[model samples]
Target chain A: MFQGYTAAELTSIFAMQGFAGLSLFSVFVLMALGLAIIFGQMGVINMAHGEFMILGAYVTYLTSNFFSEHLSSMFSLYFFVAMILAFIAAALLGALVEWVLIRHLYRRPLDTLLATWGLSLILQQGYRTIFGAREVGVTLPDWLMGSYAITDMIEVPVNGLFVMCLTILITIGVYLVMQKSRLGKQTRAVVQNRAMAGAVGINTEKVDRFTFALGCGIAGIAGSAFTMIGSTGPTAGQLYIVDTFLVVVFGGASNLLGTVASAFTISQAQSTMEFFLSGSMAKVLTLLTVVGILMLRPQGLFTLKIRS
Target chain B: MKKLQDFTRNPDAVSFAVLAIVLVFILPTVLEIFRLNLVGKYLTYAYVAIGLVLSWGLGGILSLGQGVFFGLGGYCLAMFLKLEASSPENTAIQSTPGIPDFMDWNQLTALPWFWEPFHSFGFTLFAVIAVPVIFALIIGVAMFKRRVGGVYFAIITQAIAAIMTILIIGQQGYTGGVNGITDLRTLHGWDIRTDEAKYFFYYLNVALLFLVLLVACWITKSKLGRILVAMREREDRVRFSGYDVSNFKIFVFCVAAAFSAIGGAMFTLQVGFMSPSFVGIVPSIEMVIFAAVGGRHSIIGVVYGTLLVNWAKTTFSESFPELWLFAMGALFIGVVMAFPNGLAGLYTSYVKPLIGSIRPLLKERARLYETPDKGGPDMLNRGTAQ
Candidate 1:
């Protein structure tokens, strides 16, 4: 595939493609992080996780419109506000879904999939009804509008950098919340042993609800970042769902590091291959490879040795 | 003679007889050709639903990628039909007269190697069933043998559906692309687009459905069915009892794939085209809803479920298009939460009780019962353990 390109040109191509893959990896990481929490940690397959992300995107859309209309002077700062509101909005809905739908289906993991799928459809239609079916793009502040030339041959979009930076921050936040915080400890307790955790005075129900909401909140943040690089549509969430789930599963559902690693591997492979093959073929090859590897190592790229 | 007596004495005999009457006599007589063809198309989905009842409901192997099998079946027959339709004389206007239209459009001068075998009708028929089943066998063995199942199985299968869609749509030159294998004109020079052919295909579809339903009924009623339920409730116990759990899982998965493929072939015949729209995650999951709404455990019930849901979808989408998805969403939630057993469960729980109250003696003699829901809570608790 690279037969004709000079060595310098090949180096630039690899550098540019690698950056493209890095941005794609950021999106997958954002999407899969929430899924890893909901599905991996809690064993509840929230098929609507994509919808939750889209909810964040929609929230950002609304926020951007609001900011440009009223808070024109602070329009550049609206993204930070939108990201916060997106988290709260998605988290609130996540809590409501847990109370009404997920709590009852916890014992039936597969049914959660179907029910949440239904929820996703309703959410998709709800977005369509409220926001209209056409794809919507958020207005970027002047700072996020330009591309940074890394070298003579390679340039990266500023919004891609913004998203990449946002991903790093949120991933760190998630890591801290999951590993360092008291709430994280309690949530882990509940996940590891619900009955025992309850006996030890951990509000297991509250923890479950909060854990689910937090996962959804992170997805909302991912969505907020999503608006930086791409357009959002009512059905856009559906596009990310299978891929996100694969990331979580391929990472060894319960392993956070695994999710990130798998996301990086999948995104890089796909973007790099896209240069050589058709876009669809690259996707097909990447997914086929992940699925094949998963077949061989069903436990995934990483696994925890905890007894079930 | 004993088997014949068992057939008559079977509790489902009346339900089966009623379904047969409805499909054979009432539907054909009452509905017009267009409406009847629509029903025929809906019944094609019932093939997938029936398969889900076996593999998902009974075997506890929830494959969200049933559409891949359905598409495999569809594309197999479509390849044959496209070959016949692309006979050099039929495509004399094209630059490449003998190849499929899409292939020629993509600037291919010759037929692809894969399309070569589809020219034979006998091979096409064999390939329709064989291809999907073999694919299912590969997936089933790879996953089940490793004890990968439940949600993992569902997710993996869904990914496969996504892959299949991209593959079919990407390889447009070979698979006819997103436009699908259209302008499918004949089967052995029998013009299938005609009303007479529609009627013939409708009846053929109904007969095939009944055959499939009977096979499903036999599977769910046999000792194998008992083992499946047991496996669903407690896999470790089944394995401890020396049963090859993966073998049962693989067998049912293959059976389900075969059923779906048959449905796909019929769909291609009646619908006159096969597209990626039906071979993707959305349609695949929608097919699951068909089985779910009808009562996944009830083989006969899934057909009714398929018809009812499709009928309502058509009517609802036509009149109140916006609310149709809301209704579908509600149906999925309602079926899972309020009535996990679906319409069949509702019948057994509420309607059967009311009928029994009206005639006490008749209830004992003619009661229509399926395998009890002994495994429902058992399976849920098992899920909790996992």
Candidate 2:
């Protein structure tokens, strides 16, 4: 397939596709981070994880609009404000959902999947009702619009760079919270042994809610990042839910580093193949490979030896 | 007469009898052909729901890609019908005559190799069931042998569904793309677009649904069914007891796939088209909800559940399109949280006792009338006791 390209052209193509893959990796990492905390750390499969992300996206959209209307002078910085608002909005909803829907289905992971799917449907419709079923794009500020040439051949878009930086920052924050902080320690304790954690003075339910909310907040930031590269629709969130879940699963659920590594591998493989093959064919190949690998190694790329 | 008596003595006999009467006799009499045909389309989904009841409900294998099998079955039959519909006389204007119209449009001069066997009616019918079962066999062997069950199994199946849809939509020339195989006019020289054909297909679909239901009931009632329930509860114990649990899981998954394929084939015949829309993650999960709503444990309940859900969907979507999703979402949550047993559970918990109470009272009254002096207050006491 690459026989026609000169060596110089091939290098350039690789660089371009690799960059595209990196942007995709950034999105996958963001989405999977939220899912990993909720699904991996908390054992809750929020099928509405994508919806929570969309909630973030929609929040960004509204914030962008509000800035353009009422505070055009501070338009370039509106994205930061949008990201924060998206986090808070998604976190608050996550807390509410955890309280009302997820807490009861702690024992039945399968039931939680179905119930969250239902919740996703309601959220999708709610978005449609408000957003008029149209795909909405956030107006990019001039500062975030252009691309920088790394060479004559390799050019990188500013927004892609921004998203990657955001992903890095958020990933670090999550890692620090989960690995270093007291709350993270408590959350991990709850996950390892709910009864034991509760017996030892940890409020397991409160930890569960906070963990879920934090996960959802990360997803909101992902959605906010998503608006920079792509258009958002009511159903757009659903398109990524399956892939995000796969990323989390392939990373060996409970392992944070595994999620990031799997996301990188998947996104890179997909984007590179997409350059060589048709888009759908590339996706089919990537997913088939993931599924194949998963069958062979059901515990995923990284395994945490936690005895049941 | 002996068989009838035996059947009546069966625990599910009343539910089965009532369903049979309503579906076979009452529905046809009550509904117009259009509505009857809609019921037939909905019954095709009932097949998938029934399959879910076996795989997910009984066997504890929740496959989220039943739609792939369903699509495979539908496409096999649709290919055969498309070929029959696109005879040389039917496509003389095209540059490549006799091949499917979509293929000719894509500049293909000959039928694709996979589509060639579908030219035969027998091959097509056999392939409808065989293809999906074989595919399911492969997937089941791969995942189940590795002991990948629960949510992991579900996510993988869902990925397969996504792959199936993307493949179907991408291979436009070969698979008819997103529009799917359409304008299917006949089956074995009989024009299927006619009112009589619709009625014929409806009855055929209903009969097949019953046959599938009976087979499922047989599986669920046998010792195998008991093992399945045990496996669902504790898979390790079942394995420890000398059963190759993976083999059973594979078997039931394949059976579920076969059932969904039959439903898909019928759906193609009834709807006159097969598309990627029916072969995707959404529809596959929706099929699970159909089984769940009907009472995953109840064979007969899922059929009614499918009908009710589809009926509500059609009516609600037609009237208040926006509210339909909300209603469906609530249904999913409500069924899981408040009514985990679904309609059958509700029926057993509430309706059955009411019926039970009524039956004894009527029986006691009749006995009292027959022997007024002897039966006196004892019959009343017996009725109250029941």
Task: List each model's interface RMSD.
Answer: 0.5, 0.6
Model 2 per-residue lDDT tens digits across residues A1-308:
88989999988888898887877888899999999999998778899999999999999999999999999999999999999999999999999999999999999999999999999999999999999899999999999998989998899988888889889988999999999999999999998888999999999889999999999999999999999878999999999999999999999998999999999999989998999999999999999999889989999999888678
Worst 10 residues of 1 chain B by lDDT: B363-372
Fnat of the models, one by one?
A: 0.78, 0.86
Tell me the fnat of candidate 2.
Answer: 0.86
- What is candidate 2's CA lDDT for residue B9? 53
Once fitted onto the true fold, the runs of candidate 1 whose alpha carbons sit more than 4 angstroms away are: B1-9, B358-386
User: Candidate 2, after superposition: displacement of residue B118 in Å?
Assistant: 0.7
Q: Give candidate 2 misplaced runs (Cα > 4 Å).
A: B1-9, B366-386
Model 1 lDDT per residue over A1-308, tens place: 77888999988888888887877788899989999998877999999999999999999999999999999999999999999999999999999999999999999998999999999999999999999999999999999898899887899888887788888888888999999999999999988888999999999999999999999998998899888767999999899999999999999998899999999899988998899899999999999999999999999999998777
Residue A171, candidate 2: Cα error in Å is: 0.5
Colliding pairs, model 1: none
Provide the overall lDDT of each model, using Cα atoms, as 2-decimal numbers: 0.92, 0.93
